[model samples]
Target: MQTHFNSEYPSVEHLRAKAKSRMPAFAYEYLASGCFTEVNLARNTSDIRQVQLQPWYLRDFDGADQTTELFGETYDAPFGVAPVGLQGLMWPNSCQYLAQAAVDHNLQFTLSTVSTASIEDIGQITNGRFWFQLYHPAEEELRDKLLDRAWEAGCRTLVMLADTPTFAYRPKEIRNGLSIPPRMTLRNICQMMMSPAWAMGQLAAGKPEFQTMKNYIPKGLNMKHLGLFMNKTFSGRLTENKIAAIREKWKGNLVVKGVVNPADAEIAVKHGLDGLIVSNHGGRQLDRGQSTIVPMYKLVPEFGGKLKIMIDGGMYSGADIASCLACGADFTFMGRTPMLGVCALGKYGGHHTFEMLKKQLQQVMEQVGCSKVSKLREHLIAESVPV
Candidate 1:
């Protein structure tokens, strides 16, 4: 990978810009857009900026620590890659790229239910730094089988996304004529032709098929067929009862992702879940809903120690991770950064992306006079404005 801007391009925005140039327009939109209005998506970034960090100049800042522990495991950084569905649509073998990067960086990489690569494939790369996110399959037998496969793959944690009870209406996908497995219409062909690099990657990867769900479905299933299978196989609505059932099924570190409200966080605690990723599905679920930061102060304390509280959404810089920790997040998840890394650098991109975030977080910590990542709360200051 040739250097684009050699001062390290420390910010995720720079990496994203490079990624957008390499990727197709629909791929960029798929990773960037939110639901209707996109207010929540905007707020996720703006709200983080609102929280001010207090710097202690008198203290001697010798070294910086960016490590944190969650779910009985200590991660080298406070950030991990969040699960993204249809990642192959963005770039070929995205799940594998992200997982391998997470392993190289000593961070957790979550694989989505609808990811193109299978758990076994990703496990081979990172030796199972992979966390599987479930969509709550309609068929109990099939869902259990997938869980068993994840266990066999050495997955220690299970993340059940609680927010996406109903899939939000993404206008971009509809307008782009996008469906699962992807249809190559005139519009899509032009989009692909615009980015020969991504098109060639797809060609090499054999047309971006979903290996994760291939075994469950019949042979000769195309995008339209897979889309219909997804619609029929997984029920979006996940109730408390269903969660309880899941708790009974899986004993390992169970995480309830997509929590925005404090009450729902309490429900997760009551259900004996190990952790909660406070997020608005990265603004993909409810556009009008509040950003994850808006409810962090309220929800973190509500279930911080009893259950680890993490966040994801609108995080494009290391300062964003600092802001999340200062506000209330125990750990943060990088949804697009690692993908952007792979997009920009291919096999080694994920490693570079993780290093960039780690460097940024270290700089922020040293500047704020923090020695350990856990001491981030010591420097936290709630402004009259918002952080």
Candidate 2:
């Protein structure tokens, strides 16, 4: 694929700055802010950056290959887009646009249960080649229906969220009136008007709704009712029984995201899960919790061979990805990084982000004399903090 990357915004920081300028205060805060003081959010990236790598400048080198095999498919890169709810709210049609970009670039994209795009929409866009992350509903009937729809759409991997046991205490969301039953204040409206690109895009896309759950939602309901309905619909806390039930119903690959402890990982393996995404919900759910990387040093060693030990949280660049890989993460995923790309550049933003990440990872591999994705551990020089 020809590079769609913008040289002006070569890094995540640059893209974020551009995104901040283009987006409304509420929208940017929704995408970028975390719960409480955002201690873990900042720590997630800083901790990963602390990991040092040893370069092998003189080693007999074969060219670097970023290709990685997860579950059954080989990807051009080891990282894929992490599932983000209400993607369209940040940038109109972002959920749909990212799906198309992932298809073009041969990378994986996971659609959140509450994401603005429907399961069928992403299924059609990726041609049945996407992952569905279920935010387990309160009703068993609802769960079954969602699983059946995903199966019919040709989705193979099902990611059950183990974190987000409750509604987050994000101060930004509260201040922005983005908590359940989102209220559009005059300030929000004025800010949107100020952001011409965002205002125009929202007009074109229409007001963002939960497309996947629209069928279940009653028609003509006000924002307050819709928020109440959504709040009652999802259960949030995932239990062993819920996992077992879903395992029985879902025939394809099953992965549990937001796992940070070996005990939780042991349960995932016992329940016959295919993978574990070591995450703290990108630090959205936890304020004082350990950054996702810290647990990887423990989880990867114990559960590495048993199941695919994937991770997502605070990874901003290829070097951050290399640090996680060196710590034994089988694959990586990012929500804010790719979202920053889309919010910065609109339509081709996803393609550019994927391409940039691949290029950065390629440079890291060549610099460290690591040719394949599987052997990055050899380049691990030292950990920033002991587990």
Candidate 3:
């Protein structure tokens, strides 16, 4: 395989196109679709496009610094990969591939609760460069047990997902029949036949399984039943007491994910969370919720220097990242974009995505007359009309 993407496909759209060609219709739909209507999904990127950069020219020529330090560790890039579930379904051993890429790039990679690989497995592969994302189970004992497993696996950071009270109504998944432990329907089989390379990879890896939940779920449940089981096993409810309980339980740096409101930011600080990610679940959860960047633009200033503000949503190009920095995010996290790159290009996906984003950022930095990413704020000019 060439293991390269087309020039036109530099952004996540490239991988998405490749993924659609490679994955079954059901699988592709599961990964690509957002909740009802996908209005918010489109809004995420559109909202980012609204912000224009004010570039300056003819400044002293010095290299820029993209390295960012958070909770004592320095990452070569300002952004890291956010967690996504069932990555192997998109591409075989996708979790391992992504984790290794993050390690090689000196970036953070978070493993989801329903991830195809175990935390320990990814921990070994990523060499502790991995973080763990938790889906709060209804049973306190089970929830605590899962957290303990993450800690025992040497995961240094814990990201508690707070947005999912119930699974969002993703129309594509329903129409595609994306149940747990996927079934090979005629529709799916036809779709899979279109992409021989992707089919071969899955055949080579055997079949994808939720490695983390293997110990928890009963072995008899099929894919259709798996979705229902997940619905029952996880609780979507997020409460202040739960946050306090988790903070008390996890000794490492704890970050609350899916924050869109400044009031929630204050509550996170009140709960003593180490960091907060301003996200609308990448516009996958609430269709009417404000775009992640808009809230981040407003909330970061409100929280000011007291809290570490991170943004995750609609970031594609390095220019998008620079825009986030210019707006006020201390660091950014990308979920779908990097995964799309990896699944599309295999081993080199991480390299290409990082280079792509870094190149864009460096160019923006040079043009904007900013020597450091922290100084990007001076270039921000809020638009009177959202682009």
lDDT by residue for model 2 over 1-387, one digit each (tens)? 677988998899999999999999988999998999999999999888888888889879979998899889988899998999989889999999899999999999999998999999999999999999998999999999999999999999999998988877888877787732246679887888899999899889988888898899778766542235546888879899999999998999999999999999999999999999999988888899999889988888789999999999899899999999998999999999999999999999999988888889999999889989888988887545436
Better of 1 and 3 by lDDT: 3
Number of clashing pairs per prediction, in order: 5, 0, 3
**Which residue pairs come into collision in candidate 3?**
165-236, 180-223, 181-223
Superposed on all Cα atoms, model 2 deviates from the true structure by an RMSD in Å of: 1.6
Per-residue CA lDDT of candidate 1, range 266-351, in tens?
78989899888888888877888887788888887667779888888878778888888887788899787788888877777777
Residue ranges of candidate 2 with Cα displaced over 4 Å: 179-182, 223-230, 383-386
Best candidate (score: lDDT): 2
Winner on TM-score between 1 and 2 is 2
Any idea what lDDT model 3 has? Answer: 0.80
Residue pairs whose backbone atoms clash in candidate 2:
none
Tell me the spans in candidate 1 whose CA falls farther than 4 Å from its real position: 1-8, 222-229, 384-387
Candidate 3 regions exceeding 4 Å error are 1-9, 225-227, 384-387
Model 1 clash pairs are 48-387, 50-386, 50-387, 51-386, 51-387
Between candidates 2 and 3, name the one with more favorable TM-score. 2
Q: How close is candidate 3 to the true structure, as a TM-score?
A: 0.94
Candidate 2's displacement at residue 256, Å, is: 0.4
Ranking by lDDT: 2, 3, 1
